[model samples]
Target: MSYFKEDFKYDLTSSIVVFLVALPLCLGIALASEAPLISGLISGIIGGIIIGFFSKSSLSVSGPAAGLVVIVLDNVEALGGYEPFLVAVSLAGLLQLILGFAKAGIIGLYFPTSVIRGMLAAIGLILILKQIPHLVGFDSDAFGEMEFFQADGNNTFSAIIASLENFNNGSFVIGIICLGLLVLWESKYIKGVKALKQIPGSVLAVAIGLILNQIFISSGSALAIGKEHLVSIPILSGEGGLTAALKFPDFSAFSNYQTYVTTITLAIVASLETLLSIEAVDKLDPHKRHTPKNAELKAQGIGNFVSGLIGGLPITAVIVRSSANLDSGAKTKMSAIMHGIWLLLAVAFFPTFMNQIPLASLAAILIVVGWKLTKPSIYKKLLAVGQQQFIPFVVTILAILFTDLLIGIIIGLVVGIFYILRANYKVPYNYSTGEFKTDDGREAIKIELSEHVSFLNKARLQTTLDGLPNGCHVMIDGSRSKEIEFDAMEVIEEFRINAPERDIVVSVKDLPGGKGRMA
Candidate 1:
């Protein structure tokens, strides 16, 4: 109780900021997913109210994620219709719950820090590149679409070029002005002011954008923004309108095998995305608090089950909204919950007003957020960490830029694992050739095996034994090892058996199957 009250003011302010950020995203993800616009709103609402309430996460904002847009679209088409697809989503939620209870969430802990950082950096770059089209009033692609190859005919760079060719001067002006205000709002002077500090810059930028467009309209200026340049939130007029807008799940589809396949697909993808986002969100947390991964999965399961049961798209913890929440000064889960409440209220009562705000303004805000995420300092810091870390970090960023999030992450993970193997391959044991006392006081070459030797060390171990000088006395020691892999032990045994052929004296101590001197 005190937790909510202590940060109520900050949380309220941040909730409004997140609401402004999330509104277009909800619509855009819906647009990208080919799901009904109201369904997006429903997911956002459930993500906020239900997931936010149940989630242990302090800053993560769950909603219909952009990552699942393609998956949702294809499954809907494959399953014959949106109604049947809803059954898959609900079943996916059940699978997520099973996963949580099974403690599968620990998989998130294995993601290399460099890969996670790269994911965030890639998303930052995507946010900047993708939002440019919106900023210029080229609204062909949906707002939340983040893939390299968009559902629209154009790719990321091509979209920017296309937007430049057919740019809207009004949108450009609003975006530029709003961007300037956001930058200025962060200046030392504005931040130092007590009265201004409480108010969020994004709110002011959005407000000014509205006023600027209205002023242009009043004067009948050529710079007046058009409906195409503004937000397009659907208004729910009454109960009939609500019913007409939402489509329910076809429960009968549960018996279909394809439905189960789609359910498994959604559960896996959504779980991975959620786990990744949770990692990134925790990294961004100023307080450095940890979110229990299992708890988050359960919360997402509930959110998805409720969303699909009613008529919403699939849900996941989204990094963009979470980053926006952090940038907006959110202090607790209240901001997330309140954002959902605000989404519900705004759509129900003020859809017309929301529709008036220019998309350009929101684009400007996201651009700033994007820049913060992929700042130059981050690149420099990772570079200083060494190539092992930096390579995967950069690879993840580029992969995500050229591909979608999951593909990029998988690619990055592979690269990261390769580095891990390379590192392990380099030093399997300590090799020292010196005049030392063997068990009876004779000079011998000493080979101290590493604590845990795997099969990867077999080849190197064999090569070392093969290179030993003929008739040289050698000591292969494993007394300190906790576990030696069978493959590595085979190399030791083979060397011991063959030592007599080379007239070499070999001593094996504390090793499996070979613990005595070899003549």
Candidate 2:
């Protein structure tokens, strides 16, 4: 009871914040995908309500991901229509389910900590860059794109240049005011005040944006944010609007090869994004809780399945929403679920009101969110950790800034692996040498194996063994080692066999092989 009360108390404030944050993003991603406006809402609803209800995660929020917008747009065109794409989404959900049952979710665990941190930082930086245009009502670039290269062929830097000419002064004014409000709302003193803690600053930003928009209209002010700069969710009119909006998948295309191809593509992309976001969210969670990866996959499958049924685009655990939820003081999955409920109510009875919101306001909110994700303090802390980690972390940020998310992560992982192998190869074992003569007064060398010496140390060990002098006692000690690679052990044995040729005495103590283990 106490836990429930504590969690619920946080949920109310956070759920509204997440809802406000997610609303425009959902619509923007759909606009980028060229999907129906309602499709994004459907996916957001399923991701928040259904996935959150079924998932064991305490903080992750699922939704229509911007990462999938490109693939969705392409597949929707290739498959000839939106209805067939829904079928692909359903099949993708089944694929996710099978993958979860196959235990493929453990793949996320293999990513290095440095690479994950780099991913978070890179995403933060991307959010700041990509949302800047929207902050000023420049809509030339694809909405919700986080990659360096855009769907319209402009890279991140070029897009910013374009935004300069495309800026709307009205949006610029609203965004600046909202940004200031959000920043003040997040200040230490304001957060420390108990009364302000009950109401989220993002919710207030939305209200302010709406009121200011109305004031601009009623006063006949030329500075008013127009329809293009505001959210434009189609207002539903009674039961007919709901019926027309719900798109069902057509199974007639089941035998089409493109259908299967689209399914496989969506499944792989969505699952990977879901896993990556889940890992990222776990890192951001204040309580240090871990979301079960396999369970998360299963929940995503269910969310996508339901989303597809309702004519929505594919669903994934979206990092933007998850991060927003975490930053807003979410303590349980209920925050996510309630956010979905808020989406449902807004879409059902209040879309016209929602449409009054300025995109600049939401952009300001995300700008603040992005700033929090990659604060200079985080950068300084990573740099303090040392070159081995900081190199990979920074490499990831640069790669992601210059490329896409998955590609950037892969690049960072490769660099991280290279550093790990280099570090391991440099010092796989510890050694101390003494001129302890044998009974014949010949000097000997003693080498001690370090714990968990892997295959990477193979060549180094062989080189040292080859340098042994004739008529000398050589001792290789593995007594202190808990794990030595079989290959290393074999190298020891080979040197032992070859020692006779050099008139050298070779002795390996507690080496894992032969009758012991490694042989």
Candidate 3:
């Protein structure tokens, strides 16, 4: 009971913040994918409520992801319509279910810590850069796009430039005021007061934006924010309201080859994105709780299945929503589930009120979230960790800033692997010279093999053997090793065979294949 009371208080407020952040994104991503506007809402509802209910992650918020926009657009067109695409989405969900049962979620465990941190920082940078235009009331591009290159022919930097040229005064003022309010709310002084801390800055920002715009209108001022800069959800009417907005999948598409191909693509991409999002959210969780990856995949599979049946876009664990949830102090999955309930109720009963919300207010909230993610202190900390970590971390951030999320992660992994291999190359074995000599008084060289030597150690082991002094007694010890690769053993064998050519004496000890001296 105590846990529920404490968690509910935080969850209630966090849900409202997540709902506001998710509303525009759902619509914008659907618009970008060329799907029915209501489809996004349907997917968001399923992701938040159903996925949240089933997911092991308390902090991760699932939704229709911006990452799938391009894939969805192309497949929807190639498959000849939205209904057929829904068919593919359903099949994809089935595939995801199979993958989860097969424990494919273990794939996420392979991502290095540096790469994961880099991904977080890169996303933060993207949010700050991409939200700038919306902050200033320039809404030419979609709301949730994180890719460097946009569908509107503007890159991230170019969009910022364009926003400056097309700023709206009313949006500028509201955004500035909201941003200031949020900053003030987060200050130590405000947090010191119990009363002030309970008041969420995001809600205050929304209220202020609405009231300021209304004041502008009542005074007949030109600075009034127009409907174009506000949230625009499709309101349900009294008659046939639910049925009119909902779409159903065309099951006949199951026989189509293109549908199968699209299913495979969606399954792979959505599962990967879902895994990454959950991983990222787990990193951001204040409690540092670990989420079961396989459970998350199963939850996402169910979400996509329900979404597709109702003619919704495919669903995945979205990092933007998940991060927003975490930053807002969500303590349990209840926050996500409540956000979905709010989305449903808003569409059914209160869309007009919701539509009054200015995009700038939401943009302000996201800007703060982004800042928290890519703070300079994080960079300094990573740098302090050393180059092996810092290099890949920096590389991942730059790569993501220039490309899409998956591509950037792949690039970071490549850099990380190179460092791993280089480290292995430099330290294959422990080489030392003993002052005590053999019976004949020749200087003795000793090479102690590592516990698990692989093929990566072959070259260095060979080099060490070749550098042995002539007429020296050398000892290669593997008695302490757990396993030695064929490559390293071959190098030792070859060196022993040719040792007499240089008047060198070779003695091999307790190696796996053989037990005694090859002198």
Q: What TM-score would you give candidate 2 relative to the actual structure?
A: 0.95
Candidate 3, residues 346-377, lDDT tens digits: the string is 88889999999999999999999899989999
> What lDDT score belongs to each candidate, Candidate 1 first?
0.92, 0.85, 0.90
Clashing pairs in 3: none
In terms of TM-score, the best-performing candidate is 3
TM-score each candidate: 0.95, 0.95, 0.96
Candidate 1: lDDT of 402? Answer: 96
Pick the winner on lDDT between candidates 2 and 3: 3
Model 3 stretches astray by more than 4 angstroms: 239-241
**What are the per-residue Cα lDDT tens digits for candidate 2 across 1-519?**
986767887888889989988888888888889988889889999999999998999998999988788799899999899999999999899889989888899999988888898988888888889888988889776557776877777888888788888798888888889999999988898989999866888888888888887888899988788898888777778899888877889887797899999999999989988888899899888788988899888898888888887899899988788888888888889999999999999998888888888988888888888888899998899889998899999999999889878888889999999988889887877766673556766676888788878789988888888877778787777888899878887888888887888888766778766323211
Which residue pairs clash in candidate 1? none
Query: Residues 1-519, candidate 1, lDDT per residue (tens digit)?
Result: 787668988889888989999999999999999889999999999999999999999999999998999899899988989999999999899899999999999999999999999999999999999999899888889999999997657799999999999999999999999999999998999999999977899999999999999999999999999998899989888999888998999988977889999999999999999999999999999999999999999999999999999999999999999999999998999899999999999888999999999999999999999999999999999999899999999999999999999999999999999898887777888989884666654458988888899998877788888998886789888888889998988888778888889988887777776676565
lDDT of 2 at 408: 85
